[model samples]
Target: MTEAPSPAPVRIRPEIAALPPYRQGKQAGADAFKLSSNENPFDPLPSVIEAMRSATAVNRYPDASASRLRARLAARFGVGIDGVHVAAGSVSILQQLALATAGAGDELMYAWRSFEAYPGLAAVAGATAVPVPLAADGTHDLDTMARRVTDRTRLILVCSPNNPTGPIVRQDDFEAFLARVPADVLVVLDEAYAEFVTDPAAVDGARVLADGHQNVVVLRTFSKAYGLAGLRIGYGVGHPRILDAARATGIPLSVTAQAEEAALASLDAEDELIARVAVITDCRDRLAAGLRAGGWNVPDAQGNFVWLATGEQTLEVAPRFEDAGLVVRPFAGDGVRISVGEEASMPAILEAAASALSLLPEGHPARAM
Candidate 1:
């Protein structure tokens, strides 16, 4: 007998139903290096771990407002307590901001090949995602982004040291871009990897906010530099009214007590964490330099990762690195992004990069002249 036809699936928003879930970096085996995710390679400080241990009151719900952590961040950023909003991660803030600012028929704009989550976030919010292509050098084409702004546009996301591509939005350029944007449209500067940026000219979100750009909100995370990826603590610094709107859209009590405790401890140990960031930045620079020396057109890598523009060969080239025990994030038909991992992983990374370079034609865009 033939099986009965399956019942119609429960109604999900068509966009949500069609949307792909966020893809995480591929994990590696015990002996292999897992550099797919741009994670801090260092172990948490003893103080941070101790702080987490002290937060043993899991039976009780955490502070729904995450007041202490918000207070700390506010003081650090020299903002009023209400000016800071803490959440599970900076991505959560992005979601909240999208919900707060845009809705069905509204448009949310950002640079293409950025954060990867931007399109999904806009779709989830029932907003249209307007992605402007990156410039040839893998940086945001801010001028094009400004020109594309429509009256329906409600929110914009700017990811600096843009994910996968590894180039930053410069300060002067960012300021000029801001000037062209209408004052009513909200701009969210997603700076998840800010700590890894060593360039003197990269846009500093703190400085931008201090300059009183009311339309701007700077989102940062403890995930990258502080080794708190698992805890998921991140925050946004902006005008209180804007943050309040985002907070209203957020899920209450999502930031756990352990995460708050750990974040506070991480801040207390800032000097040590900054030093670790320096090491990773140095490793990133060396790795990029090595790739360039081998004739690969590596971009100005300001984050804890470097990009290899393997183009149509991305799928084929990624396996070469995997075979070399390096798990990297490959954007099919685009390129590969290998996070700057431990110093010990450098040799294998460089070797894999060199092999990938060999697959390119003599004068491909990914090759240096």
Candidate 2:
């Protein structure tokens, strides 16, 4: 008993100990519409389900390299198989890229209010995270970002249609910024919601690559538009050397054979997926328009969600929506992100928004101009 009592506590990294684990969007009750996670609202296609079922190898390990999926993505993007990498999700690949490039005494830069995973990923890599603030309109301030880069900067994440805020990085603007960055620094264009983007002016990663930007990587996911969130498959396209680094750092065999089959089936049914995306985009437009009419300062909203600048009222208003049977993601000091989910969820969402707007203090940014 005395020997057991003498055992000391285990030591852990202080920075990691202080950091919180990634918090997913809140789940809703059975009667509630969960628009919190920015998940695709559509059910998986029947063919996709069949393909997953056909991948009946629970006892065996998946392709460690996800070679087949990589080849398919390579063909689609006009890249060599070596230029593509797949993972349980694009976010996982992102963490791998950060691990491969940055470490203790290094820096990873990204815009603030971006995908919530960035800061944590950098921290886990023992790298310093430098977050540049977005402009008041909620778009990345790329010019400021370039000036902030230093010799210590190893990686930079540019989340197009920046998550939680939804305004995409314009194509011309991004290309110019890419020109400003040093070639040695890795630049990742995270386009998780790319399929939902209707803005013709937004950055198209493939086009950027074709233009000979070698240091840039484009991350895409099957989770959103393809309705494969549960399967968790995503990919990245970049130079072979860069992708090889990512693959080297990745968790072995994380992408399941079932996930790969589902993704392949999803590609086979791309036409139907595109049609579903159109429906979601339509719903997003209607929701944004409704919010704007009710005095909310909705942004460009190029993704499948709308941003509400509730400012200090964020915490106050979020509960109202939750109580109203519509769950949304609220960033305390910033605003709320409402995903474009089921068509039937819209009325509840609109009603909750109108009520929340009414409750805001006079002249709040979320108020109608």
Candidate 3:
């Protein structure tokens, strides 16, 4: 028999070991209401499910390029086919971008605590991470971010309608921010929650790209808005040459034929799917208003969820939420982020928020400064 390797002999990369693992949603039991992970609560579209069922070509590998999905996306975005490349998910695409572009003494800049993966991806790719702090309003401090940029900075990430902090960077501000930054550095506008936004001035990465900016690449996924969290499909669009470069590096990484079929069907049902998003937008607004009424530090969110800027207060009150059968997302020391799903998680969540207000320690900041 082949000998089993000793644990000590496995000289793994220290950077990998030093990394804090990504925290997923908490699981209570079979009947728990999980609002922890920001996934859409709806079932997959009938069209999407049917596509998956018909895609039984499990005998073969997926197309490395994911051409059909790309074509569909191009039509939707009104971009050339060469401008899009689909991958396992936007998070996967982000990691690959960090590897392919930013590395070896280069610096990767992004808002602090925006996406946990930013630093991990930077470390794995042998790059320096410079985390710019968010504004007191819990939005990207674009001016400060622009000031923090240096020649060594190889990549800049802008998360519109930022996760955990629901502020959308205004388009005019981003255009100015884009103007200030050096073009050599690849700027990634992560629009994972793009479909949920209803703000008039919100920075739309697609519109920005269509404006003919060369180095700006936009990342989006089917996980959130499309209700396809299980599929792990995402794409990026940019200058054809730049996107093509990212594509060339993304070979051998894609979903099965089943995933492709489902994605195609999802595209066909976009109008219906978007109508579903309208409901989520409503929920987001109602919850934000409700949280404010209960005396929590809730922001004016534009995405599918509202965030509690309660800081340490969240830690103290998180258990109360658990007791109410609502699983909320708490970032240990930073704050709490809750995903607004259906009417079910709301009553329990609101009750928990009320309890949280009373249970929290004195002198905790009640709202964002």
Structural similarity to truth (TM-score) of each candidate = 0.97, 0.97, 0.94
Which of the two, 1 or 3, has more TM-score? 1
The C-alpha local distance difference test score for the whole of candidate 3 amounts to 0.83
Of 2 and 3, the candidate ahead on lDDT is 2
Q: Candidate 1 on 228-268: residue-level lDDT in tens?
A: 99999899999999999999999999999999999999999
Per-residue CA lDDT of model 3 for 1-369, tens digit only, reads 999644546787777767768888786566667888899989999889999999787787777778899888888778988988788889877887787788788999999868777888788888998999998778899999999999899889899889978889899999999999988889999999999989999999888987878889999988899998888888898878777666666647476777778778888899999999998998888898888877777766987877776666567867887788788888877877889877877887888888778765666665422
What are the per-residue Cα lDDT tens digits for candidate 2 across 1-369?
355333228887878877778889999999999999999998888999999999997999988988888889999999899999999999999999999999999999999989999999888999999999999899999999999999999999999989989999999999999989999999999999999999999999999989999999999999998998988999999999998898899889999999999999899999999999999999999999988887788988988999998888899999999999988999998899999999999989988998888778888777767
Instruction: Give the candidate order by descending TM-score.
Output: 1, 2, 3
- lDDT (C-alpha) at residue 324 in model 3: 80
Sort by lDDT, top down from the best: 1, 2, 3
Model 2, backbone clash pairs (residues 3+ apart or across chains), number = 1
Instruction: Give candidate 1's root-mean-square deviation (CA, Å).
Output: 2.6
lDDT of each: 0.93, 0.92, 0.83
lDDT of 2: 0.92
> What's every prediction's RMSD, in angstroms?
2.6, 3.6, 3.7
